[model samples]
Target: MPRFEELDVWKKAARLSADLYKSMAELKDFGFRDQITRAGLSIPSNIAEGYERATDKEIANFLNYAKGSAGELRTQIYIGMDIGYIEHETGKCWLIQAEEISKMLHGLIKSVRSRTS
Candidate 1:
């Protein structure tokens, strides 16, 4: 496996996570800040962790967790938008990024599974 830092998807996800954190910090008053913030942080964190995993199955599990976190981020983005804690454009942008990350994770997992099978 290539280094975790060499993966484009991982790099993108890391950047997305950092951006999300910056955006979230501006909205500290959001009622569920801690939960949503953790979810956002988890997306890229899991991606990097999974990429560093020694086994294919382990990587797959972590990727699945990252995918789940992407879903959580999407929901949180919507909630943030609905409550006016975040702008629609900002939320939509992050949602798009989350969707992309999900696709990349799904593809990575499929590739790994096929190779192992």
Candidate 2:
């Protein structure tokens, strides 16, 4: 398998994390900003961590965590939109990206499981 950084999903997740940071950089609420950014960061971090692990099972497990973090980030994006912390179009774009990342993680997890089984 290619390195985690070479994976399309990982690349997208890393981009999303950077975008999130940039988008929220001016927000005044520290708690909300920190949580959202951390959740966004977790997606790529988990993917890299899993790929470096010893087995496909471990990789799949970490993918699951990445998926969970994607969901968390999506929810926070919605909250940010509702509270006017994020613009409507920006939130929509992030939400779409998060959903896509979750789907990618699901596919990767399935592939890993089949190979490990």
Candidate 3:
């Protein structure tokens, strides 16, 4: 198995999570900030957990979780933008990154599944 830290998708997801945390540091809306940050954090965390699993099936399952979290994060970003919590440009960039991360997770899951079959 490969190290999750070495994966580009993991790196990007981690960065995005960090960026979200930093960007939201000043926001007074604790509920919104907490939910968004938690969703952002889950993406990379799930990827790492998946990569650490012993079986290909487990890994693929975790990757699916990560992909789902990416979608969750993107949804929160959209809501944030709509509510004026997130700056339009910053939210737009995050949306793109989340989508790309989801794609990367999908590719990784396919690769793992191929190895199984």
Candidate 4:
């Protein structure tokens, strides 16, 4: 299997992480800064970490963690928007990206699990 860095989903997630970081940086005083940014960072980092492990079960487990992080980021984004720290449209875009990344991670995990089984 190609390295996790070589995986398209991982690449996209990384790019999304960068984008999210840039977005959050503008809202430095946002109430959920630490939690939201960390969750966003964790999603792709976990994917890469799990992929580097190179074991199907390990990768799947990491992917699940990535998905969970995505969910956490999404919720935090909503909170930021609700509290007026983030623009509604900007928060929506981030939420959508998180959802997309989560689904992609889930699909990758399912594929890995099936191949191993």
Which candidate order results from sorting by TM-score in descending order? Answer: 2, 3, 1, 4
List lDDT for all candidates, in order: 0.83, 0.96, 0.95, 0.84
Residue pairs whose backbone atoms clash in candidate 3? none
30-70 per-residue lDDT for model 1 (tens digits): 56777777887897788789878888888889889988998
The residue pairs found clashing in candidate 4 are none
List the candidates' TM-scores in order.
0.91, 0.99, 0.98, 0.91
TM-score of 1: 0.91
RMSD of each: 1.4, 0.5, 0.6, 1.5
User: What's the lDDT for residue 21 in model 2?
Assistant: 95
Q: Residue by residue across 1-117, what tens digits does model 2's lDDT show?
A: 889989999999999999999988998999999999999999999999999999999999999999999999999999999999999999999999999999999999999999977
Tell me, by lDDT, which candidate is best: 2
Tens-digit lDDT track of model 3 for 1-117:
669999999999999999999999999999999999999999999999988889999999999999999999999999999999999999999999999999999999999999999
Q: How much is the lDDT of residue 88 in candidate 3?
A: 100
